[model samples]
Target: MSKRAVILAAGVGQRLQLAADAPAPKCLLRFDGRTLLERHLRLLRAVGVEDVVIVVGYEHQQIADELDRLDWTPRPTLILNPQYRQGSVVSVAAAESALCAGGDVLLMDADVLYDVRMLAALVADDSADRLLLDAGFEAGDEPVKLCLRDGRPVELRKKVADGLRYDHVGESVGFFRFTQASATRLAQIVRQYAQTQRGGEPHEEAVRDLLLESPERFACADVTGLPWLEIDFPVDVIRAREVVLPQLHPLL
Candidate 1:
């Protein structure tokens, strides 16, 4: 079956400032002569996933203008979320139509700059519900974590309680694939979060809800030693250009 992808790019990326207090759109960060958004599009096409949707706000027109500059065939669809300042849940909720389209769907964050190998690994997985994990992530509350018990996903959150029992834990790559049925359910949960104006809850909360209730439905793919960075802070931008970019494709 064909798969679709929804990229959540609506947030202001407030933490990733370029100059003193200047919050730029994270997806527009350029590396190797291509914007992160452009790289994502090319990589998805490489893996045979062409049907794409992006949620944009916080200078969304810049995104639209960027899309205009690219001559990519079968241009991506854009979903605007004016409430991007509220929380990520609203952005996910805004893509409800695309999510509930009854096809296998992949959801991912726009801020990550990673090896194309990571994207390839995700697309090739056969699991009905999928999440990417990397054991090498730096220790901090900033990265969302995936906690597994006996090879099944038991918990996922930014802050895993100190004593939670799990065989192992890894940092989430912020990329996920869900079966048609699973996608529908996830959309509903986020929609509820959006409708109720739970403005502080990140989209991860809805994902954690589905995960805890049905651990049996999910499986994880490990991408240890992979070169990837979520472009959250200024330091990451420097590292991506200086460190991660060279590692994404070492032989090139």
Candidate 2:
């Protein structure tokens, strides 16, 4: 009955132009002197998640070398996704296959920056399938449109209708807490999409599709006040440095 975490870090980070010339992938981008993955590992370990797995692609060797240098006595396992260029879903599927067949797994996006407290709350909460909903400050195509019914997420589409305005915090904070059953279900969906050559779609695309095709499979977890940021493009790098650096430096 151990808790685990799987970080999907294989994407090429096409928007992060610096990644092309940098020494490591975007996840390896240094913020306040520590790599993003190192901070995430510390946060996960603090919350009793001793077993960790990271799916690496796009400069995956650099990621592997970084991990090898760590003196983390009992290091987490690393899964290399050969088809990482395919999409996030493929990276997730790779991690899922590496996980213990029947244990709970926490899934997170490698590029997201957030408060450790959010993760602590997620670890403590009990949810069959939890999706963190951010009450964003802006309304743009960057964040998923969270459609709620009775205080729960009923539908999450890419864009809402024109002139329809709701506070959209942004895209997923890249973190999820799940039971083995939920992990298995999600993995099944990802696998189905990957095999059928539809894996190029967004990770949430598959999740949303599953919900539409079968409503009983997912649940929403409230994280309205949590401070989080998703670092995808160049501008987000500054934002990530601003928010994640201050909080993580002292710990690192």
Q: Best candidate per TM-score, number? A: 1
Instruction: Compute the lDDT of residue 48 as modeled in candidate 1.
Output: 85
TM-score of each: 0.95, 0.87
| Poorest lDDT segment (10 consecutive residues) of candidate 2 | 164-173
Local error of candidate 1 at 72, Å? Answer: 1.7
How many residue pairs in model 1 have overlapping backbones? 0
For candidate 1, write residues 1-252 as lDDT tens digits. 779999999988768766645455789888988899998998888788999999998889889888999967788999999888888988999999999987789898999988878877887766668889999888887989898999988778989887888998899899998888888999899988987858558898899988887888887889999899988888989999998898876322
- TM-score, cand. 1 vs. native: 0.95
Report lDDT per candidate.
Answer: 0.87, 0.71
Candidate 1 local accuracy as lDDT? 0.87
